[model samples]
Target: MELNNEVIINNLVKRFDEIVAVNEVSLEVPAGSIFGLLGPNGAGKSTTLRLLCTLLRPDSGTASVAGHDILEEPVNVRECTGVLPEEGSHTLYPSLTSYENLEYFAKLYDVPEEEAKKRIEDLLKFMDLWERRNDPAGELSTGNRQRLALCRALLHNPSVLLLDEPTSSLDPIAAKRVRELILKLAKQYGQTFFINSHNLAEVQRLCDYIAIIDEGKILLSGRTDELRRRLQSKQVFKLRVADNIETAKSIAEGLDFIFDVSIESDSLMLTILDPVSNNSVLIRKLLNANIAIIELAEEEMTLEDLYLQVIKEEEQ
Candidate 1:
């Protein structure tokens, strides 16, 4: 693999008896970029992550992480990557204090005593867990525990992080904090992050690149903005008119730039090719026909909409 590529999967496949958990999957994640793997429940997301992490070998095909082949150099792959599995707290010790838990893992990762202490202290403070550093991890709230697990993953300062639902257990406020931390780390340390999430909004907000998978097959993959643009061909505008709603709808439908028009009571919803330039023409036509415009606003395309559209397209 090239140095610029942090992860590369070539026709990777994994199976259990008759069930193919992952099939002919291939992808590339650039170094220092945040990439998200999005899919529905039981879509082989976790299985794919396991293959990349070297915890489960692929039945066919190959993959590499941080320039180390997962099959041939599992040890090097492990050394260069940190993983926070879906059940993140499974790696934590219930009997150990939050600080002690991190300390122990730092030692296991071969971090020097003094350096580990400094990193742990900084991480705890950053995650707002310093106040409860001495409390047993089991006593911490689910959100706090998740935060602790994240801190542990970063304790070694590995180059690549494989995170499965990193913010699943976090409250809105804590989840926002985690997102900020991930961005900061990625920018400052040039760390590459491979995230698996069912939260479409979260992935849209944090990931520069995204891949949508279903039934062990990739349906869509590209830069987040590019994918959104590719799926959105026309701009939708919602207009509330005071009078002559039928006239307004007719005017919109008659325009060359407007492709479709729908009427809902006193409102007119228009599908136009270019809202910036075509909206004025629509309003002028409405006014010429004695229609009173009350409100006009463009409906924004959301990640949820894009996700569903792609899935629906694939099904059809």
Candidate 2:
């Protein structure tokens, strides 16, 4: 494993009775990158996280975290990694005040009293929970409690963070706030985050690298931008015409570089083989045919589009 990789798994497998939860999974998360593990429910996303966090030993396979072997150095692996499981509040004490809950965990992590105080105050303020610092964690809203759980994970300042649905239950506003905080922390601390999420949009916004898993297997994994380009085999464009819609469609379809064309009201949507060089030629040909060009633009492929395409292909 390279030094720049914070986590590496090789053919990691986990089984419960006769069913396999995680089978032959392998991937490497680069240091300081926010990597997303995306899948539908019961797709082994959470199980993979548990195995990496050393909470559940893999039935077979080897992995490492921050240079410590998971099987040989479970203690060091746990110490170097922080986890916010699906039930974030389970790590908190409902009866204990937010401040007290964090303070208690800080002591367990052996963070010095002076440093813990400073770290606690800074984290509370950063998460915008300073005012609720003295209130019992159970009294805070769902979003606030999630923030508090995040603070607890960061109290010890571990090198890697394993977050399972960090913003699962929050409203849009609260979810956006959590996303901003994750970006800010990744930028400021260079922390490597391994996140398992069902929200494709959230993962698209916050993660630079992504992997799609299903049926205890990895379908694909790569840099987000690269995946978008490579997975979308065709480029789609929208071209609006002032007149002669039928004529414009005919011209576009006749072009060798154009693969597909669809007419919509006064516009033509063309799927071209080479959008970068063929667009200008397409417009020139249409204008020459006496079709007035109103507008031309390329459509970007979204994560949702990619996800659906990959999943549908796998099913077929």
Candidate 3:
């Protein structure tokens, strides 16, 4: 089944007495996809998430999760969604066993006993925690505890997952596993995920759509690949030459399309307006002049680079 706006927000506004946390923000998350809410420390990503999860009612706005209105059907919305907050510890009972913890949450969500047992076992095995299922949640290593916390959130088979910094405290290996699991769940169950993260590379790899927000406002939002393509039009290309880098720089400076070229020990860097369709022409022109190109590669801007640029511009 196609996702019909798994999560929707319109004119969302929230405040904390004197400080505005969310400011008329609007966004939509298509079903069965990972939508990233990326921004710096105080970008209001968390406030936006809380509004959708029905944890905190918006001062003014309309939102729906899984077609259930945030204001009109908040209980129903909560029933269909699971949230992994920034602090996973908040959801975990440190004194309980992994299996027992999931069992309790499953019961709270009213999962049938028989089905809950099977799901709990399957999740424990899937997370490679079956052997340690009997262990105390407080005794597990930090990564193992995080994995257990994830299983807790999935116990009721939620249709939509609201994750905040899922991998922030995980090691590299654990983080990769969490990423793969997120993808697997989305494909297998057609789940929709709304993720808040500052890990740019991770967002670029896992999120199909991304929104960069700052100071309670969205700076940019679009398909990840499309954003990169649009930014590609403003990329800088680096050309390493065997020798005569000075001469190559002089030639590059004269080309109008070349925009600006800087010289290093044995390389020339060219910042262009748009080289998507002109890279080949630039290369041939240099080769024809005996520039002996060692390596000509585009130094594409990363999501982090774009994020920093956006934040800096917003500050100014």
Candidate 4:
């Protein structure tokens, strides 16, 4: 699908003192999709986010958010986007109730009182915070507080959402709810979401597009499905046989297409560079050897696996 490319970043760079926070990073975020900025800590994700939100200036390169240049038209870009900063604690007023917090941010954003009130209530309900609307922000659970923070972020209904670790502090159930809500909002309202997360499973399940960064540069970026396809190029498979587990594994190790072989419980795992064309021949060879075939399956690679691969490749 051809996306509108709500976010276009080209050769972006940011430096602090002698430290380069973001370096020559570039990617396009499609409109109306959940895009994940994923990496380990200190991988430049947050710094890139800061630049995009206009909280920090890039030393070089260019970025535009929602059709507005981040550097040249910061105010317009800010007006077009809502940011749920990493410091969610600082974003919420501890002494104020959830409703009051939203009211305050709404007013700050110049949302009219009548519209703000209705929207606040709608957001509270949408985030499942209605019952706790009157509760003080300081006293709400981490999850509730996070929900309140999100409500404040949406108060102005900006075209894009820049969320940094939206579910960092929530319990699994709460995190799941937040994930579901993110998907719902992205679909129902056609809003573009840029999420910075260290949660691999969350990113894998939620984001349609992803960018993996390390040090100060982008290691890889593309559609999630495409990335997975790239991983399939390094596919591996495990086969089980009743006898000669060791001998069968030796045979697999000798095959031209096989990279390595290891023994598992009642099975032999073959690490192959290509499985699509080699698997059938390997299985047939084992069957002809009178080895009782019990199980045969491809090893599925997780997002964590792919992430490790990206980081390792970048390191080398």
What TM-score does candidate 1 get on C-alpha atoms? 0.84
Kindly list the per-residue Cα lDDT of model 2 for residues 159-190, writing each as its tens digit.
99999999888999988998999999999999
**Residue pair clashes in candidate 2:** none
**Lowest lDDT 10-residue stretch of candidate 3:** 300-309
Give one digit per residue, the lDDT tens place, for model 4 in 1-316. Answer: 5658899999999998888889899999988888999887888888998999999999999999999999899999999898888967567998999989999999999999999999999999998899999999999988888878888888899999999989887889999988999998888888999999887678888999988877888878889889777777776678888888977987787798887578888988777777788888888888887788888888766556676766766698
- Scored against the true structure, residue 59 in model 4 reaches a CA lDDT of 92
For all predicted structures, in order, the TM-scores are 0.84, 0.80, 0.85, 0.85
Give lDDT tens digits, candidate 3, residues 1-316.
6547898989999999988889889999998889999887888999998999899999998999999999999899988998888888567888999999999999998999999999999999988899999998999987788888888888888899999889889889989988998888888788899999877778888999999887798888889999767666666778998887887887788788886578766778787767767778778888888988889887756556686656655598
Cand. 4 TM to true fold: 0.85
TM-score of 3: 0.85
Better of 2 and 4 by lDDT: 2
Clashes of each: 0, 0, 0, 0
C-alpha root-mean-square deviation, each candidate? 3.3, 3.8, 3.3, 3.1
Which stretches of candidate 2 lie above 4 Å from their native place?
1-3, 232-304, 311-316
- By summed lDDT, the worst window of 10 consecutive residues in model 2 runs over 300-309
Q: lDDT for every model?
A: 0.87, 0.88, 0.86, 0.87
